[model samples]
Target: TQLLEQSPQFLSIQEGENLTVYCNSSSVFSSLQWYRQEPGEGPVLLVTVVTGGEVKKLKRLTFQFGDARKDSSLHITAAQPGDTGLYLCAGDKSGGSNYKLTFGKGTLLTVNP
Candidate 1:
């Protein structure tokens, strides 16, 4: 089984709406990262949460790490057409040695203008 599971594999909303995506895992991770990817491009990191119970925000996006460091959530307010993309969550368990990331399948979001 995949280490990370993302909910709402796909989402469709109108501009100005709000949405939330979730990533969950039963195993603990040293760090978790959120990324957004556009069509024909790679995923760009949006936020990285290393500390448990940590929260980070970027513009209209909010990211939170679970207190146990096993899960994370992403919230986006006032969604825009530009916000449409593939949202991905990845977890790192390397003890500062190998830099391998376990990525979730990804959540696809589509915002209609």
Candidate 2:
């Protein structure tokens, strides 16, 4: 089974702080994606890092993929109340009828105003 485990299942902090979340797995995947979901809306794709050891930056967020393609990490430069949401890391495997993604349980982040 291709399962991705995320660390710090829950996090709470004051506004204007920094935090890093990790996702690790024993299975290899073709690509990894990070998403942030707000209250009612669906998860929004934050970044997608394909190459091993690859890193991508989006505003105040940085995402990195492991060299073995089995792990990934997300670092937020300065978290805000607006950043409060569910952070999920997903992996895309090769075999699947549709573009299916295996999502982690998710890390719930709460940024106090």
Candidate 3:
């Protein structure tokens, strides 16, 4: 079984501050997905990076997949209080619908207003 290690299990920053969270693994993945879970709610899919060295952006957020496809990161520019949530990274080893995903413990970020 493969494992994805996430850094900085907890984070607290004031509004407008920027932050970056990372997820890494020794095993290669076919695709990697980022998710955000709000209090008392299920995780929401943020983005999916399939190609090595691929980068995707969502407004003030940027996602990057490492060239080795063994890691990824999420960067938030000028973060807001609304962005406070549990940021999780998941990796998919099998490129199909019938496979399970390995998840990281996640970084719990609290953006103070």
Candidate 2's C-alpha runs over 4 A off are: 95-98
Q: What does the lDDT read for residue 42 in candidate 2? A: 99
lDDT of each: 0.95, 0.92, 0.95
* Residue-pair clashes, model 1: 0
Clashes counted in candidate 3 amount to 0
Residue 90 Cα positional deviation in candidate 2, in Å, after optimal superposition: 0.7
Q: Each model's TM-score?
A: 0.97, 0.93, 0.96
Hey, what RMSD does candidate 2 come out at?
1.7
Q: How well does candidate 1 score on lDDT at residue 3? A: 89
Q: With candidate 2 superimposed using the best TM-score fit, by how many Å does residue 34's alpha carbon deviate from the native?
A: 0.5
lDDT tens digits by residue: candidate 2, 1-113: 53999988999998889999999999998899999999898999989889999999999999999999999999998898999999999998864454778999899999998
At residue 111, what lDDT does model 2 achieve?
Answer: 96
